[model samples]
Target: MSFASQAREEIARRSTVKACCVRAVCYGIACFAKYFDTKGLVLQTEQQHTAQYAQQMFACCGVEGTVVEKQRPSGILYEFSIREPEQVERMHALFGTTGNETSIQIDPALLRCRGCLSGYIGAAFLCSGTVTDPQKEYNLEFLTPRTNLARDFEALLAEHEFAPRRTRRRAVNVIYIKTSDQVEALLAFMGAEEAAAQIQRQKAVKSVRNRVNRHTNCETANLSKMAKANAQTLLAIRYLQQENALDSLPEPLRQAAAKRLEYPDLSLSALCGCFEPALSKSGLSNRMKKLEAAAAQLKQKREEACNEGDCTEQPAHRG
Candidate 1:
């Protein structure tokens, strides 16, 4: 199951204080339900768990509501409605709503107590919240159809120092937390400790995986550069051999060239270890540069000789 669903199920299984449950149920209905002139309310959701949780909360609050199931092309939908005037009035009082309007607004009184605040946020999430897999990304958002409700919810999150961001996607308004720490805090606030821990674990794993990939890529690039340098060194050594100049080189430079040709794949540092009294990397590098210079001298002489031969082969110009 998805993390969002898991979180909702966790919230549903936990026991909440009566006052908290009543406030939560009121918030859930106000945010999710369609109202008819203060006399009736209707809530439709695809999640059976949310519907069941709402029913339990209403029962605990001594409010009467009906649960109905409908089949749609997408899936089964659970519908909860409160038509009794008395029950509607009680909900309206708890949420400070007029019930005549469809827009949702948070009443400061409903969130005065910490428990009540937590419950209301949790219930609002059950209605329209979703979280992306932490393994892939950090994103947790509440989706609402009403722009004013989304703005109010953003303000509520800000009051708690959550610093949520708001955006509109088509007809839906999204209030989202993109930082992993904030998402974790939201889960904890909603009383889903296990889900919060799971997100932490996933983040740790992702960080480790990224670190490993970067290290491996660095090592591979270093190896490639070392191989290219070794190939160029061998080509220079070949030039010395063709010119019969290897024997005239200084002993250390000749040794460096021979060792490099013998083990073409070894790095300069590794090649230093193969020497009889283990030369330092700088010592071996200096010797190799001298050999390359000798090879370059031979190439220049050969080019000059070719140019001279071409001039001599041409007929003398008439005076």
Candidate 2:
């Protein structure tokens, strides 16, 4: 089966899977109704809206009511009611949805101006700036979401040499364009290159935000190792030492290992929490061991010299 057919089937399967067997069968039956004429479906008055919608679309596009219908091998009925067969070619060139024509009803109350930058202003809202009507009507499903809508709209308006007034209604943004002709021009630009670019920019921004969020989430869980110090961290330690704890150790260690030695008793993993740009636990442990071993060797050498002097002085008298 075709991918779309399979997708539709999958959607149907999911919708029915959670219901009782009888309810599931009812869902399957509903799926089959898609092949028949919209009017033929047994539904409530409000639910019979599709039949009326299809008829309205047929009239708007100047198509006759008569059309061919068929039952498919998959048990779904397919119907075609284009006003003209050439309308199919025109639609494919225009909106890019292939095969059957569907009706889109836009409410003036819900529709917002797309501004001068877009070709879709008459048919759809640009969905940006401050809308005076908080309850403004627009095609919610057809356009991108409202986040950054004003910024996007302004950018598009700048591109088109139109200055749009930004206003807010009920916290929703609306871009006010002065003329209806501009709205028509905006509608005309729908599915055009400039509109596509605007939408593309929106998608790119969304992608960047998503990537940043994912990175932060991963770091919180996985960046547990003690990282090595950068120049800034080393500098911070140097400044801290000049103020206090001056007599704790020799000057060489104070400068070289000052920043990293803050949590001397901690294991590498524990030490990572004490600084910025943390190093791996193993790396921190190794550096600490090397410093400790050197200090131990120096102490041992001093003890050996003192013991030799004592032995040389006492042994001569005993003999």
Candidate 3:
């Protein structure tokens, strides 16, 4: 099952303070309902557990509502509507909704206790929130059609130090938390301990995988540098041999060149071990610099020889 489903199911199975539960269900209906006015009230969701929880909430509040189920292209939809004037009035009083504004505010009574606040946030999530797979990303967002309502929700989270961010996608406003710690904290606050643990496990796995990849890349880069250096040194030694300059070099330089030619794939430190008296990596590097310089001088001389030949072959001034 999806993480969102798991979280909602877990929350639905747990019990909370009666006042907290009433406020939570009220907030959910206000946020997710299709219509919430004196004329009628409608609360809809695709989650069966959420629907069942909503029914239980209404029952606890002594309000009667009709539950309807329908099949849609995406999934099953559960819609709960309270059309009776007396029940609708009771809901308005319970949620403290003004019923004429573009935004809904949390009832102050809901914030009087930490438990109530937790329930409010949890119910809001069950109605409109979605969490990305932790294996892919650390993101949990509540999608709401009303921008002002989303802003209000963001402020509510910020009031509790949740540090949510707000953005608009098409017509909906998204209030999201991106950090894994915050996502885990939110899940825990909502009574989904198992889901929070799952996020932590995924984070640990990702951390280890990233460390391994970085180590492998570092090794690959080092090997590539070693190979390129070895190829250049071999080319330089070959140039000296072709020019009949190898036998004329000091014994140490000649020995170094010979060893390099014999083991073209060895790293500088490894090649140092082949010397009679082991040379430090820096010492071997200095010798390589000398070989490169000698090869450079030879290349310059050949270029000069070619330019002179080209000049001599040209017809003497054609005045």
Clashes of each: 0, 29, 0
Rank order (by TM-score, best first): 1, 3, 2
The per-residue C-alpha lDDT of model 1 at residue 124 equals 80
lDDT of each: 0.81, 0.37, 0.82
Where model 3 places Cα greater than 4 Å from the true spot, the runs are 14-27, 35-41, 57-68, 72-74, 81-104, 132-140, 143-151, 163-188, 192-228, 243-254, 275-279, 286-319
- lDDT for each residue of candidate 3 in 14-62, tens digit (9 for 90 to 100): 7875676566655665666667666657778888888778777777877
Which candidate achieves the best TM-score against the true structure? 1
Residue pairs clashing in model 3 are none
TM-score of each: 0.76, 0.24, 0.66
Listing every candidate in turn, what is its Cα RMSD in Å to the true structure after a full C-alpha superposition?
5.2, 19.0, 6.6
lDDT of 2 by residue, 1-319 (tens): 4222222222222211121222222211222222212232221111122233333333333333333344556553334333344643442332233424242221122222332112223112311111111113211111222325445544555466655555666665555554433432332343223333433455577689999999998875554432333333344444445434334656544433664545444444766555456666666555555455555554566578778874222454554
Residues 123-230, model 1: lDDT tens digits: 888877888888778899998888877888899899997989999999889999999999998998888889999988888988999999999999999999988877
Relative to the unseen true structure, what is the Cα RMSD of model 3? 6.6
Off by over 4 Å in 1: 64-66, 84-86, 89-104, 132-139, 145-148, 165-174, 177-184, 192-228, 297-319
